[model samples]
Target: MFLGSYFVLSICYNLYLSFFRNSKYYPDPITHLVAKQSEALVDGFGYNAQILPHHAELSMKLIVNQVYLARIIEGCNAISIMILFASFVLSFFGRLKLSLLYILAGLVLIYAMNIIRIAVLAIGIYKFPQHTVFLHSIIFPLIIYGTVFLLWVAWVRIYAKKQNS
Candidate 1:
């Protein structure tokens, strides 16, 4: 009973943090900084750069929360998203205190993944302009979702259901 309540509370807390807190969220601060850095890449790295119009679209739609929440609710976000989701799952299965470790680990992993995604997207746009749409719209989302799916499976096999058994 206590564990169930903790799971509910943790979900609520993650939701609140992602939505209501509205301060800073994982990868947001770093994401913003990276965006700035990316702009200078064209000149600095001599790599042709094109603005990712989706950035504006995502911000305009507040997709950050959407992304985070969707991943949490679905128990998938990409490998990193899965990591974050796992923390919540771990909190429930491993007990709440130990879950904090999962959360921290998830944060680190997510940040790294976010950076890789951004870098790949940027390069994809620069090198294969025509394929940018496919990369951004299809491939990236697929990677994220696919990773999430695998993570959930792993969580079930290794942690969540494992604990229950």
Candidate 2:
């Protein structure tokens, strides 16, 4: 029952985002926000970074030191990841107050991590363009997904245990 509802709600929310959240001026709000935050992070690290919206697609190009380092799309926003995280926590259905607080904290952590990931990827691409394919396609994804997986494991072992006890 929980799984079914989670899937339904997740799919519906994604569909709605696909249709209504995108625009010619920017990617979806979440993706745009991610791109902006990533740019800020990169800049803070003493790199010149800018996020330029793609004219023909739902993506933003991350420009570092006048070179295009990455295209941040909807998938990079971390919203889908958060949805998955929330669904799993909901399925487990721990204490109401604790679960809600955990979800909120987890989402914030994920978002902050994603910004850092994007900034690192941009720097990696800028400094090592030769390895762009491997870095973007493999290592970076593993980092994000691995973090999410660890968060899930921690929740099960820590917060969820409280409910069982």
Q: Which stretches of candidate 1 lie over 4 Å from their true place?
A: 1-30, 34-92, 160-165
lDDT of 2 by residue, 1-165 (tens): 457757976897778687765464376777888999999999999999999987777789999999987799888988878888888877877788988898899889988889988999999999999999999999888878888898899888876468668
Candidate 1 TM-score, true structure as reference: 0.51
Which ten-residue region of model 1 has the weakest summed lDDT?
Answer: 65-74
Model 2 lDDT, full chain set? 0.85
Q: Estimate, for each residue in 1-165, the C-alpha lDDT of model 1 and write its tens digit.
A: 445655665686567436632443323433334454443443345554332323322221112211211111112123335444654455446555645565555555554555455556555655676786788778766765565555456545656554767
What clash count goes with each model? 0, 0
Against the true structure, whose TM-score is highest? 2
How many steric overlaps does candidate 1 have? Answer: 0
Q: Tell me the lDDT of candidate 1.
A: 0.47
